[model samples]
Target: MEPDHEVLVVGAGFSGLCVGIRLRRKGVRDFVILDAAPSVGGVWRHNTYPGVAVDIPSATYCYSFEPNPGWTRSFAPGAEVRAYAEHCADKYRLRPHLRLNTRVERAVFDEDADLWRVATTGGEITARFVVSAVGPLDQPKNPDIPGIDDFAGTVLHTARWDHGHDVAGERVAVIGTGASGLQVIPELAGKAAHLDVYQRTPIWVFPKVDFAIPTPVRALFRIAPPVQRLVRLVTAAASEVIMVLGIVHYSKVPFLVRAVEALCRAHLRRQVPDRALRRALTPRYGFGCKRPSFSNRYFPTFMRDDVDLVTTPIDRVTPKGIVTADGREREIDTLVLATGFKILELGAMPPFPVVGLDGVELGAYWDEHRYQTYEGLSVPQAPNFWLMNGPYTVTGASWFSIIEAGATHAVRCIAEARRRRATRMTVKRGPHDAFTRDMRRRMRGTILAQPSCARSNSYYFDRHGDAPYVRPQSGLHVWRRARTFDLDDYSYGP
Candidate 1:
C-alpha cells in the first residue's frame, strides 16, 4: 500500500486550510488538501448574496497568528473575508498542496491494513491519516415544499447566488427570513418592483453595530496584540451574555430576552407603520433562539413601499407565482430561497463508499447513533480517519477560532499517530460514547433546546435530534481542549 501522504485533508475551507497550515508548521508537508469547489473561502465564497457581511465584528474574525490591519469595514463583507482566506493561502503558499474541484466520493478504514482507503470523484488516494474539514455550512438545503423544483421562474438558494439572473424591476418571492434572507432582502428590496417575503416563523433580530475600522486603528492593532485581543475579549464577552441567558438557562426566557424581543418589536412597529403588517412580522420565539442576527438595516428594508411580509403558508408554486394556502396569488419572476444548508452532510463522507472496520458504511454508522469518536476527532473503529468541526463545535463567535481549535486537535492526533508508529488509530467505544452523551446532556441544558428555540428549520440538530454542532460554552474552552490532547483518552492500535 502506498501513502498519499502522512495525511489527506478533506475540504480546503477555513478548517482544512488551517489544519494544513498548522501541519506544515509541525513539519508534515506530505499532505494534500481537497475541495469540491474550484477555490477557497468555503461558505464566504459561496454565499455571495447582496449585503452579505459578517454579523460579528472584524476585530476577532481572523487568525491568532496573523492579524489584518486594513479591513475597510468593521463588519467585513463576503468579498473581504474571501480575500482574507485567499491571502492566507497565498501567504502560506498553500495552493500547490491543494487539489481544487476534486470531491471525495468515499473513504474506508482498513482495520487490518491500518489505513484509510480514500476514493474521490477524481480518483482514489491512500493516506496514513484522513482529516475531514469539509465544513458544516457548505451544502445548501432546499425547503421540502412541493414543486420547489416546479417553480417556472428562477429559484436560487442563497449559497448558489445566480450572478447571471436579474431580479431588477421584477416581482420576487423571498422564502425564509433567516440570516441569509435578512441580508439579501435589504439589498434586493429597492431593486425588485414588488417583493413578498414568505416567512414561516419570525426570527430574533438585533441591530448590527457595524462600522468602519479606520486605517490608523488597524495600524495600531497591527503593532499592539493587546488591543486586538481586548477587542476579541469584549466581543466574546458580549456574545457570552446571550449564551448565559439562552444556553445555560433553558427553562425561562430572561427579562433581557424580553427586552430584546420588545426592542425588535418596537423596531418593526417603528419602521413599518402599518400596524397590520407589523403584527404579522413579530417573532413569538425568544431573542436568542436560532442564532439571532444583528442588523441595524434589516428591519428598515421591510418598511419599503414595495416590500410586503406574508405569513401565509405556501400551497405550491405555479408557472408565474407562488399560491398561498389562503388562496392568494402573488406573481413573481425570481424566487430566492434563503433556506440554510444541510449541515449534517458537511463533514461529508467520500463519494464512492466508505466501509469502516467490518465492512460498515460510515453513513449507517452515524445513523445508528454510533458515530462514535474521541473528542469528535477520530473514531476508534475507523483508522486514520479524522473529523474536524465534526460535532459540538459551533461558536456564535468567530468560526476562525473553532477552525484553529479543530486544526490544533488534528495536528495533535497526527503527532500521536506518528509517535505510536501506527498505521491508524481509533478512539475506544466507551470513551467515544461517554463524551457524545456528555455533550448531549450539556446541550439539552442550553437555550437551544428551550421551548422557545427557533421553531423555524435550523441545521443545528443531528439525526439523533441533538444540538450536536454548537459548543455549549466558551471559545477559549474549545481552544484549550484542542491545544491539549490526551492519548490515554484514545486507544492506539496498529
Candidate 2:
C-alpha cells in the first residue's frame, strides 16, 4: 500500500502532541494523532481521583517551549493539566489531524512497500513512518487478590474512577499506598463514614511544598515570558542536584540519602505524634528503592478518627469485604483499588503487536534481545518507526523534559529520512547494542538495582529483575543528547 501520510502518531497526549507540534514547526504537516480514548490527556484524563495534583512544581512540569502563565497553584491539579493539554492542541491547530476514539491495533513494516501498514479500529492506514507515543503509565493494573471479583459492593480503580458511584457516608476500603492512593485516601477520608487503607508496604512520604500562584506572579509571567522560563530552569536545577547527588548515588553517598530520610522522618513525626502510628508508617527499604510520594495532608489524614491504616496482608476478598491473613474480615460498602499503572511492562508490545522486518514481532524480538534500543527511541529491526516514552527513557526529573527530548529526536530522524529521500531508516545494530551495554553498566550500583527492591514489588525492574525503565543519567543529559540526533547511528535505504 502507498503511504496515506508521511507519519502516523499513535497517541494524542503530551509526547504525541509534542511530535505534532515539532513536526509542524519543521514544516511537516501530513500526519495524524490517534488516541484510544475519546479525549486527550493520557494519564491526566484517566486519573481524576480526588486530591490528584502534580507532584513536581508546576513551573517545571510543563513544556519548556510553552509555559502556562495562568496555573492557579504552584502544583497544578489534574483538571488544569488536562486543560493545558487541550490548550496546546488548540494552539498548535492539531484537532484537524487528531482522531479520537481510534485505537491502533497493530502496525507492520511492509518490507517491499517501504511503508508501515497500521491496523486500527478506525481503519488501516499506511504511513512512511510510525511514532508510538502510547505512554508507559497509560495502562492501569489491578491487584491479584483472590476473589476480587466476588466483591458485592462497588469496586473502582482510581484509573477508571466511576464518578456516578457515591461513596458518601459509606465504608470505603482503599488498597495500596502508592502515589494515587496517598492522594485519594486523604480526599476520601473526609467523605467516607470510615476508610480502611490497606498498605502492603510503607512508602516514604515527603511534605509537599504547594501554594497558590499569586495574581501578581501570573501577571508577571504573562508580561515577561522569560520569567516563567527562568522559574522552570531554577526548578529543574534543584531537582537535578538531588537526583544526581542523592538518588543516583544513594549507596555511595549514604549521607545524601540519610539527609532526605531525616526530612521525611521529621515530616512523619510532626504529622503523626503517636509513636505506634509513626512506626507503622516508617519505611524499611532504602529511600530510592521504591518511588517516593509527596503530600502535605497524607500523613495528617491518618490522624483523623474516621481513617484506619490496615497493615495486615490481604488473604482474600469475600463477597462483602476483605479478609486478612490473620483471618479478620473488614466489611466495606465501597472498594477503591489504587494499585497503580503497569510501567514499562506494557504487555511486551503494548496496545498491539508491531511486526518489523521479516515478520518478526517487536514483542518477540525484545523478549529474545532484552529491550536493546538506540537511545530508547529507535529499535534495531524496527525500520521507519520510533517509540516515545519507551523503555529506559523515563527519568527522575519532570516527565515533560523526557517527552520533549524524545519528540525532538524522532522528528529530526524523520526529517533526515525525508531529506535523503530514503524509503526506510533503521537503527544500526551496533549502536543499539552499545547503548544497551552502557545502560546495564551504569545501572550496576544504583538504588533500583539494590537487593531491597527485589521484594518491594516496584515496577522499576523488568522481568529479569533489572531496572530498565530509568535512563541511568541526569535529565539534562538526555535532553541535550536528544536535541542532537546522531545520524551516523542509523542506516538509510532507498
Candidate 3:
C-alpha cells in the first residue's frame, strides 16, 4: 500500500525542524512537521516565564548554518530564542509543511504494508517513515504533593506562566530550585512583597558571563559571517572542554571537577555571607552528577531581606499556604511551582504510545529491558522509525550539537534506503547491542557512575542505575561518527 506521505515528522521543534530542513536538502520533499502547540519553537514557544533565557551563551545555543547577529545579549532571552526558531522555519520555507495544534497520540507499524499508521488529534496519517522528534523535555512534570489542588491561592507553573497574573505586592512561594528556579527566583525577589524559596536539593551555581553585544560587533558579524563562526568555535570549544573534563573524563581528570567545585564555592562565599545559609545551599553530591546551572543573581537573591530560603522539607499544601515537615506553615497569596520537565520517564522518552514490530510497545520495552538505542537514533525492531533525541544521544553542552548529529545520522539512513529502493530499513541487533555495550563501558569513566551521584536526585541516571542520557564522547567525536558510520550496520529490504 502507498503511504499518505513519504515521511511524517512527529514534532516541529528544533529537532523536527532540523530533520525537516535536512530532509528537504536531501531531495525528500514529501513530509510534514506536526506540533501540539499553536506555533513552532517547541520548548522555547511553551516556556515564557519572567526570567526565561538560555543558560548557555547565545553563540553556542544556535544552529551552525543559521546564526543571528542581532542578539542583544551574549545569553539571549527566551523571546529571542523563540524568534530564532520562527526565523529558521520561515527562512527554510517550513511554514507550508507545518501542521500546528496537532498532537500525535500513537503510531503503529503495519508489518504487511511496511508503513506507519499514526494516530494524532487530527486523525490518522500514514507514512513510509516516522521520525519521533518529540523532545524529552516536552512534557512538564508536576510535583505530586498532597493537597496541591486544594490551594485556594493563585497557582503558577514556570512552564505555563500566565502573563496577566500580577505577582507584585503579593506574598509568593516558589518551589524546587532547579534551572528554572535559578532564573525565576532572582526576578521574583524584589517584585514580590515577600518571597519564600522552597529547596529540595541545592544546585551548583556558577557566575554567568552575560553581557550585551555591541552594535559594532553585530555589524561585523553580519558583514563577515566568518567572524561569527570563529566566535561560535571558541564558545563551543569551551563548552566541550567542560563536558569532556568535568563530566565524561571525570575519573581520568578529577582535578577539573575539583577546580570547578572550588570556583562555585568561592562564588557562593562571595554572594552569601551567612555561614548557615551557605551550608544549607551546598550540594552533597559531585559537581557533574546533576545538571549544574549558571546565574549571577541566583545566589545574591538569597541575600535579599524580602527573600527567605526555606530549607525545611515540605509536608503538604493547604488552602492558605504550604506546611513544612517540622510543623511550620507559611501563609502566602500565590504559589509558583518551578518543578521541571520529565526527562528519564517512559512517558517522556516517547511522549506517546509507539507500537513497533511484533506487537512490541516502545515505552514498555524500554521500561522492561532498559532504554537502549543505536547511536540514540534507531532501535533494532523499530523499522523505518528514528528518534532524533534518544537514550545516550546527548553529546555536548549545546543541544544543537545533538540535534545536528542525530539528524545527520537519521537522514543518512533514509538516504541509504532510497538508494537501495527499499521500503524497510532496520538496525541489526548485533550492531545495536555492540553500541549499547560500548556506551555502558564508557559511562563508567563519567561522573554519573560515582558513588556520590546516588545523592544527586538527578534525572540523568535511570532506575537501572545507568546514565544513558549522555553519549560519553566529545561533541566532535559524535559528529564525526554520525557522518562516517557504515550503512551496512542496518539491513535494507523490500
* Best prediction by TM-score: 3
Q: Rate the local accuracy (lDDT) of all candidates.
A: 0.77, 0.87, 0.91
Residue 149 of model 2, lDDT score: 92
Give the range where candidate 3 is weakest over 10 consecutive residues by summed lDDT: 393-402
RMSD of each: 2.3, 1.3, 0.9
- Please give the lDDT score for candidate 1: 0.77
Question: For residues 82-103, could you state the per-residue lDDT of candidate 1 as single tens digits?
Answer: 9999999999979989999998
| Clashes, model 3 | 0
Instruction: Pull out the clashing pairs in model 2.
Output: none
Task: Give per-residue CA lDDT, model 3, range 185-293, as digits (tens).
Answer: 9998899999999998899988899999999999999999889989998999988898888889999999999999999999999999999999999999999888898
Candidate 2 Cα lDDT to native: 0.87
User: 1-494, model 2: which lDDT tens digit per residue?
Assistant: 56999999999989899999999999998999999999888888888988889888899878989999989998899999999999999998999999999988889998998999999998899999999998887888899999999999999999989888889999999999988898899999879999999998888988898899899999999999999999999988887766766767666876888888899999999999999999999888778777887888999989999999999899999999999999999999999999988765536344468889878888766766577678988887789999887778876667899999999999999999999999889999888888889988888767776776776777777676777778788898898898875897999998
- Best-fitting candidate, scored by lDDT: 3
Return the candidate ranking by TM-score, descending.
3, 2, 1
Q: How should the candidates be ordered by lDDT, best one leading? A: 3, 2, 1
Better of 1 and 3 by lDDT: 3
Candidate 3 displacement at residue 226 in angstroms: 0.8
